[model samples]
Target: MLCLGAADTGRELCHACHLELPWLGSQCRMCALPLPNDGQLCGQCQTSPPGFVRVVAPFRYAFPLDSLIPAFKYHRQYAFGRLMAELLVEALHDAYRDSPRPECLVPLPLHGRRQARRGFNQATELARPIARALELPLSTGVLRRVKATASQQGLPAAERHRNLQGAFRCVRAAPIEGRHVALVDDVVTTGASIRSATRTLLDAGAGQVSVWCIARTP
Candidate 1:
């Protein structure tokens, strides 16, 4: 195994180490719920609203990744962001079959004040490297969070939805018109943020929208 200790900067990992993560297996590739076998969209997504067309994530917000996100977000250790992006790319390649590819990537936005105070949007940080890796167009301004809501950390699942309701807005009426979009975030908890972002994209005329993230909270 390629350990962090054996890496270039003693922090950035070698490619071999990055490839070792336990990627989510046999997910629907649409909603990202693990499949009994493997398929693109499941019966559940076919029956009802998935909010987003698909989701791509490598890790389940468990183990080393869970800790690494906080380390990057709260501690400003930007290296973790790069590692997370690498993992996200792995997931995308593992999941999707074909594409006009996504026309652009939109990181789930944080309200302006919070982003300023934090010195960075963690989602943006995570998305940057992935966009570079994938050579995909990235529109950071495509989605904006108009309202600043309370942290969802300790809130009950039901309350989490309430806290984030109507929190995001599309920059224009039809930003994603007839284009495929991939929405990104660092970690998805309850999928509230992604759902809100996806709704905005669909309303804006996106033909399809997918979610790609470093981790999924489960």
Candidate 2:
């Protein structure tokens, strides 16, 4: 396979690995899943309101699309983050046609030790571009993971919420007060982490908190 970076490839991204992924697709607007290329909210979201006001996932976390995520997340290929973020900005435009916009964007924070070892926060890297595109303040430090815990993978989906209980805490409330803040993350496997994050923001007095992830495992 030709490398995406090679001059002869002449491709912005490697088609063999993944195409230019659409961060915003014809998804159930509430869940961010591909619909029949139409509508605002899907049947599921319309029936019941999720804890979050809205969830906007640009892509389904599958196939070759999943590969590049780990490349940037685990190995620090920061450029790929730019692609993910741009797609998310598109998703945001599609999601908020009628609703008022958020005041700021916050990246899902990593615990101190995990970040110290990994040397960076993957979510923060991905959030940077969207924050700039939206002209929204990025306040990651406001919410933090006080505890470093097990990977969400391999856990039962029902137990996911319990596992993440109290995992997040808000250090400062000023940034989010009465603001429609959005949470940025690389993926949403179980929705537990984002729930915890929303809990933190709500506790900190955020008027509204929506989740914007690159991909969702739905």
TM-score versus the correct structure, for each prediction: 0.85, 0.82
lDDT of 2 at 74: 88
lDDT of model 1, residue 212 = 82
> Candidate 2 — which residues are off by over 4 angstroms?
1-29, 33-49
Candidate 1 residue 198 C-alpha distance from true site, Å: 0.8
Local accuracy of candidate 1 as per-residue lDDT tens digits, 1-218: 12635665333676566556656677775667666677766675676666786677777776677678899998898877876676567667756657556878888888899888999998888878888888987788888999899888878866887887788888864557788888888876666778777887898788888888877665
> How does candidate 2 score on lDDT?
0.77
Clashes of each: 1, 3
Q: Name the runs in model 1 displaced over 4 angstroms.
A: 1-3, 8-11, 14-20, 26-29, 34-48, 173-175
Q: What Cα-based lDDT does every candidate model obtain?
A: 0.76, 0.77
> What's the CA error at residue 168 for candidate 1, in Å?
1.0
